[model samples]
Target: MYRPLLRLLPALLVMLASASVLAEEVQVAVAANFTAPMKLIAADFEKDTGHKTVLSFGATGKFYAQITNGAPFDVFLAADTETPAKLEKEGAAVSGSSFTYATGRLVLWSAKPGVVDDKGAALLRGEFKHLAIAAPKLAPYGAAAIETMTKVGLLPSLEPKLVQGESIGQTFSMIASGNAELGFVALSQVFEDGKIKSGSAWVVPTNLHSPIRQDAVLLTRAKNNQAAVQLVAYLKTEKAKNVIRSFGYEP
Candidate 1:
């Protein structure tokens, strides 16, 4: 028994040394709309690669401002393609490292069982006092919401009832908390395993608004960080894509 234990010690030490050398921590700034899926992905990434992720979720516009002002984020996952492209142009992100991570869907949702109709006629009916949406200037989902309302010819009529949230996460919170009876939100927020997890919703047609092509990029600050590179690569993996799809996003 003593001889076996002595023989195993070298292998155990080698394994420990490998783990210590390979493991690293990466800081990521993610869009509010991608929060749920990102959390799951981050967990899986850490488990598989022995790397840790520090995630921060918020409005893409705010993240852009922070990144340009020298925020310490190693990676940026934006809610739209433009922000990442802009960062690349501005030299804040590594050029050619950007790619579309997901295509988001919009939904007209209500926490209550029947407040929202399947066809989303509630907007025209004007039954609710407040309709929450993210601030269009700050969030791609909010801009899509505006476009949908316009396409349905309800913007002018429903403008008075519109309530703006600083980010999509806040808008979802408003609807979930009953502060707004119904609102426009990302499908991922209320969907799970091929259906809305709770409440009622009408999936907004893609034709109603410009496509929401969310993109991810490696930030210049982490250009040489191995963990950052691994994280970006991890997002493109089949495991990550599956998680994204489970959250109702097209990966």
Candidate 2:
């Protein structure tokens, strides 16, 4: 009986150690514009590593607030690089673990067919009574939209015509619901059939706006999670890059 007990004790201890090494599932706050690509990548990561992702999608600025207040997110995928850097500086993010994952594009879109012309000059024409845009103070895409308007000499004229939303998703909704005749939104939001979908849009010329360098960073909350490290590594892999590009983003 003593010999059997001794053998069983060693096996039990080994099993416990194995349990200890099992990685914790990671929680993520993702920018709304990145929703499509992130869904695909998360599925692949789960299949490859047996790790899990719990994601919340919305404006990057709002997520920053939750994280700063000690929300449980273990990773952040920001719509712009600035917030990630700020988080790192503030000790909320892990140093040296941040990287740009994609570059985003701006578009002028309308859900109503023929309401917008192919070239998007219709915005300057002020044909629409209301034009929706993301709030420049809360979302980087909003900043890009304002920059685009200023570059094209439309800011002064368009400023009064603009309606602001708190996030990209809300901007899209304003356009879709006809609350605003057209809106400035992320290009990915209008994608369909390997190209821009619905009504009409002008892919805002890249030179008109600051580079929309979207970034991802590990948070201090997930410092010890092997799954988070592995997932970040995977984002740089060709598999993940392909998915991002397919969603109309550039790596």
TM-score of each: 0.95, 0.90
Per lDDT, the best of the predicted structures is 1
**Candidate 1 off by > 4 Å:** 1-15
Query: In candidate 1, which residue pairs clash?
Result: none
Model 2 TM-score on a 0 to 1 scale: 0.90
CA lDDT, candidate 2, residue 170: 90
lDDT score, candidate 2, position 90: 97
Best by TM-score: 1
State residue 195's C-alpha deviation in candidate 2, in Å: 1.2
Q: How many clashes would you count in candidate 1?
A: 0
lDDT of 2 by residue, 212-233 (tens): 9999999998888888878889
Cα lDDT for residue 110, candidate 1: 96
Give residue 31's error in model 1 in angstroms.
0.7
